[model samples]
Target: MPARADFPYYDGRPVPITGRGWILLMLSVAGAFAALITIPAETFPATLVPASLFAGIPLLALAHLTKRHWTALFGPVGLKQVGQMFLFGILAIIASLAAGVTVYLLGSVAPNPAVAGMGAMSGTAFVLRLIPTIPQLLGEEILSILPFLAFLWLATTHLRLGRTTGIGVAIVSSSLLFAAAHLPTYDWHWVQSFGVIGTARVVLTLAYIWTRNLWVSTGAHVINDWSEFSFTFAASHVPIGTR
Candidate 1:
């Protein structure tokens, strides 16, 4: 058996989640998804405050019960780590854009409706819209990373899978779920959601798996989203030239 120190984000603690813990996790994820889809857009920003609380508080409590420190789950943040995260974020942005463009060129994806709408907005309006995304993106990481770790735990412990097999299962399954979660936003387009966004999730999930730091993955996600948003904003604002 490997020592606890061998794990990413290890702080020499046992991170156990009981069957009841899994139940609570499922409930929290379901509730958050429900709130996201049901809430009125006019009041959506306000809803996220409570939705995030609902989704996050229980998971935090589970981490405490498991005797894992915050640093163990999220990894410690410092100036150096932040700089590293920024670089990883840039990598994530480039990878996602490359995937998206490739898929688009292959006719595997249509123009994304959400991005198209954003491109119709003025630059200032786009910036205003992006403000809420910061917190929302963090919340999304909480949703994604917690389940990822939990699934990895269950796979290795209960299923008796090999470490590499377990990690592969956890990454692919969680990333697919993450991609499926975006279906409503993508107008239920499988090509866009699964093909494009799903590939991006795999990249982001690998970042977390490699660094074992939520901050690194979150930084990557934030940069990826912001880069896409900036591109759309610029396209909207730029004057088209014709000879």
Candidate 2:
């Protein structure tokens, strides 16, 4: 195994978890997906249980692989990282808006039923769902970044791609997988899922690429979704004739 300068949490090695370690990592990822699909609960606090497992399983595997230094997955969340969050969050919002408009022009966009439910929730219930979303979103960041680095390693090492080309391959492959994961959520509408959600993932993944810190991307994801959630809630209450 060789060390590279791009991905973090690998102690500078691109493929830190080689041999048996990589297999364990894949198992954890599979286990996380299993928890997500098989868990019976669909609402609030109970939903948090599966979310925890989704993030915890791979993280614990990383912890063992990294010799208890898995905390490196998160760089310091100081003011700098907070600033990065807002910066990248805005970029992601812009990217999504552009992609959304394109998708809308090309074809109809399917609405997320979950967001539709947001308009009807009580204030407390809204906040309850919002609270769980933060951790769940962190799980999403994990789902994206870990595989990204894996693909990066594969491209560079096995495929012998130059670093730049390898990174491009990783980005496209990881974004495609992220988009595919949302197919069920978006009513199997490949156009909207790949157009909007996949486009946004590229911007969010840039946060990690720029800083090598998962927390920065997680914060950006929270800012992007939270702002959208808040706006949707507010807009839902607008008077019928106001538009």
Candidate 3:
């Protein structure tokens, strides 16, 4: 595995992003959340607008900061990478299952309102909602991977930590951030957020750490969530008390 902050845009760049750049990137993410609330998402299709901004703004800031090298962050998306996407996506789901079990044993697992909301949705409505997930999941992956890389840079460069140590710290820190982002989604359930969601993040992040490609990790994320959504939709249509 590449070490010493081999993250795209953070490495081999014309000008490396500085602390100020990190602040701007985070601010762009904050602005995205602002846009999400300011805009109406009552309709399923209307969600595309906010989801697009959520994915676009931080990505645009990253490209601008790195001299318009957006491709570097996306990396290659060939057959091999697609295979990795499915592979890591399965792994993430399994990890979340185990984490959910453990958390349930400890206390309770919070239900996801989004998945529950799909129970009433028609096939057409489900597809419409699925459309928004493309950008929404991309935005979710960007939010996680960017911070993972940033913390890796901080640990290796400033903290003078070893490569493995830096990666571990980065994964934990970024996972916490990912979990925190989902606080509202899980109805502010800290246990579920930090336990189940955070655990899934650890594996999804590894997809990126291994490939240095955001697309791979993002694809894995999409697979994981899409599978859940599909399951929810299918179950909703299944006749109750029937095999």
Q: Which candidate is the best by TM-score?
A: 3
Error of 1 at 222 (Å): 0.4
Better of 2 and 3 by lDDT: 3
Residue range 1-243, candidate 3, lDDT tens digits:
755446664443645778788778878877876776578886766889998998998888888887666666677789999999999999999999898998889986678988999988998888999999899888988888888878877887789998789889989999999899889888898999999999999999999988888899999999999999999889889998783
Q: Can you give the TM-score per candidate against the true fold?
A: 0.82, 0.91, 0.93
Q: Higher-lDDT candidate among 1 and 3?
A: 3
lDDT of 1: 0.70
Superposed by TM-score, candidate 3 places the C-alpha of residue 142 at a distance from the truth, in angstroms, of: 0.7
lDDT for each residue of candidate 1 in 1-243, tens digit (9 for 90 to 100):
964343432122345456676667656666766765575564335745654554466456555556445456567778876776677777777766787787688775556566678877865667667766776677677677767766776788779998788888888888788888888787687877877787878878877777777787887788888888888778777777821
**What TM-score, to 2 decimals, does candidate 3 have?**
0.93
The full ranking of all candidates by TM-score, starting with the best, is 3, 2, 1
Using lDDT as the measure, which candidate wins?
3
State how far residue 165 of model 2 sits from its true place (Å): 1.5
Q: Where's the lowest-lDDT run of ten residues in candidate 3?
A: 3-12
lDDT of 2 by residue, 1-243 (tens): 764235753324532667566668767877887787689876778978887888888898888887755766677889989999999999999999999999999988899887888898778888987887887788889888888877887787778888889889989998998899889889999999999999999999999998889999999999998888888887887788995
Better of 1 and 3 by TM-score: 3
lDDT, candidate 2, equals: 0.83
Off by over 4 Å in 2: 1-5, 9-15, 239-243
